[model samples]
Target: MTTLLCDADGTLFPSEEPAYAASAEVTNRFLAELGAERPFAPEELQAMTNGKNFRAAAQELARGYGRDLAGADLDAWVGQEKDVVTAHLRTVLRPDAAVRDPLRTLAGRFGLAAVTSSASSRLAACLEVTDLADLFDAARRFSAEDSLPVPTSKPDPAVYAFAGRELGVTPDEAVAVEDSINGALSAVAAGFPTIGTVQFVPGDDREARAEALREAGAAVVVSSWAEVVELLT
Candidate 1:
């Protein structure tokens, strides 16, 4: 049976609108506190923030601000933003039932796992909210916390590799479901058959992103996780 490695954010749960908004608010607050002008608009920040872990995004923003903020400051900033974002998220973010049912169906036929850039704690919260917390084998949940060295952030193959390792499978035998270009690329790089979910319709860029992933070797680009199940099954 093929082992399925899925991305968490835009793949398992809907894009966190509240978290994105809170990120903008916190970023603006941080800038104001640093006595700096807003360097990027909310949309721009959101674009950068997507498909990245909080710490990495925070460090990138710090560099953009010329703050050289690292270590504790970066950690604290990420922690604060997560707390603020998750509070708002608890009410709004929900799983796509369309995807969940297929996952339940597929689970009986394949070994299912979640490989995400999110921290375990945050992933746990999302899983609980989505009612998918108990569906996965506990050993199959791979998170950023399991990332080694530079933290196995996506677009890099390490995260997918870790998930495959946990399942005792080769990446080639795994099928990865992702919603972002980076996440799809990571699986492709790891030699997994990758399916990209186009969660947003970003006009010209949407086609461009899909083309890029296809060029980078994604097996297919789909609009929903249900398509992934159909393709595999």
Candidate 2:
């Protein structure tokens, strides 16, 4: 049977606006508590945080605040920020139930799995919040604790291979739905029929990233989960 592997963050949930806002607020407050001034806006901080790990993003933000923070200080900042972000995320994350129905329908015809860069806990929270937890037959959620020999993450294809292995399917026998460039590239690189779902269409740059994914060998680019379901059907 064909398996449909899906991404979680931008694919299942929004771009984490409320979480970013909370993180920024906590960051500013933390800086003030340390007798420092805020350096970046929430939006700017959000951009810096994207596609990066907690420590990396935290250290980057600290540098912007004119502090050479690393080690425990960076870790502490990230921990505090995470607590604030998680609280806010629990409220503001909106899942597309429209997509969930289609996923359920597809599950009857094809195996379904969630393959995401997020830690299992966060992914589970997202699935629970979206009421999509029951739709997936399996999930290959990655975390820092996973001790794979290779640095396997999105855009590397190892994560997709791992998911396919767990689902008892080959990459070519599966379809992948992804929102980010890295996620799409990972699926394509793994030889899956990858579809790029454009969650954010920023002006003319819409086609740019999509075309880049296409050039990297994605099967198609779509704007919605409906389109992905249509292709699978």
Candidate 3:
């Protein structure tokens, strides 16, 4: 493949937990505003919404709580969550030699792009904090939330398709590196050869998570960036 479409969040860095932890307050407030049964604790919320974005996760839980999200001020909630979570992520994200070294090698060999379901600003923050910003240019960073006209989440291939068109390539010409089932589904559905990794998943859950990614149409699943580099190079 000529281009490497790398997913952020769980794939690039372990930002899922802390990002979700940051979202807890806003999510709980959203739940209460919707008159749901009770507020969700940070860990509980993270466990429940593991790989989803705020809008998707909130709506899914709202259904369980007998609330309709149709007319909710979703923009407001999304904005608030982004504000809190981005700030929290900046404090927690750090450079990891494990991912950075392999990624640096890969960047020299392929066109590296940041493809994520996060807002572009948040993606920038994560990349910056994790010492990965230089590998991807601002033009190469595409976000499903901020880059797409409709702002949809993963498992919807609009963002990937859009990236291909913008980058002058087709799906088959690119390799997708994703860490979650939905993320894998998105890339595969868009016709990219996907490599799924559970590197950021907890030790006990990695195997099961890898299986899920395989089922989602990832060509193969890996546990670390070293394996990723080995396969690509």
Candidate 4:
């Protein structure tokens, strides 16, 4: 049977704006704390950590400011930023109502699973908030916390591969729907047919962002759930 593996952040959840804003805010605060000359632009900041795992993103942000963070300091910084971002997410994250019909339609034809870079608690919260808890079960849900090394995040197909195995589906029998460059790369690397969604990108930049996702490894780029429903069906 075909399995539809969906991403959480910008795919089912409309969290791009809040996530980007929170990251930028936290990064700017960190830079100020370090007495940096300038903060990174929104695009630059997001591009740096968009699909990266937590440790990697934190390290990159530190390096951008020429800070050699290690041990407790690094952990503290990363933790603080995460707390801030999580708080912001709590206030704004919501389901993409536009995907409701598509999800319902596809449910009849394919098994569904959620593959996300978030931890278990966060993922659970998202599913609950979106009323998608019934569509995904614990066995089929894969999160960053589920990774063997404990924090192995995306762009490293480990999570996707694990999800495929857990769901008893082979790469060819699964389709990954993603909304970020890294997310697309991870799915493609895992050998799933990948669809990139531009729903989270700004209207003016959708074309460029979609192109970037395609370059990153997505087989197709779509702007709406209607298009995705058509393509998959």
> Which prediction has the highest lDDT against the true structure?
3
Per-residue alpha-carbon lDDT of candidate 2 for residues 193-219, written as tens digits (9 for 90 to 100): 888876554556567867876886777
Candidate 3 — which pairs collide? none
Query: How far out, in Å, is residue 146 in model 1?
Result: 5.3
* TM-score for each candidate, following the candidate numbering: 0.87, 0.74, 0.94, 0.86
**What value of lDDT does candidate 4 attain over all alpha carbons?**
0.78
Each model's lDDT comes to: 0.75, 0.66, 0.87, 0.78
lDDT, candidate 1, at 120? 70
- Give per-residue CA lDDT, model 1, range 1-233, as digits (tens): 47888888877887544567767878877777666664556667768767777776776666776778777776788788777766666777666688679889888788889898777767777887888887776678887644455554677778788777767898667788887777877788888888877755355566877787788688789876677777889
Roughly what TM-score does model 4 have, to 2 decimal places? 0.86
Runs off by more than 4 Å, candidate 3: 63-72
Q: List where candidate 1 sits over 4 angstroms from the true fold.
A: 33-35, 39-41, 145-152, 200-206
Clashing pairs in 4: none
Sorted on TM-score, best first, the list reads: 3, 1, 4, 2
2 or 3, greater by TM-score: 3
Check candidate 1 and list the clashing pairs.
none
Comparing 2 with 4 on lDDT, the higher-scoring candidate is 4
Model 3, 15-99: lDDT tens digits are 9888888888888888887786777788888777665678777668778878767544777788889889999999999999999
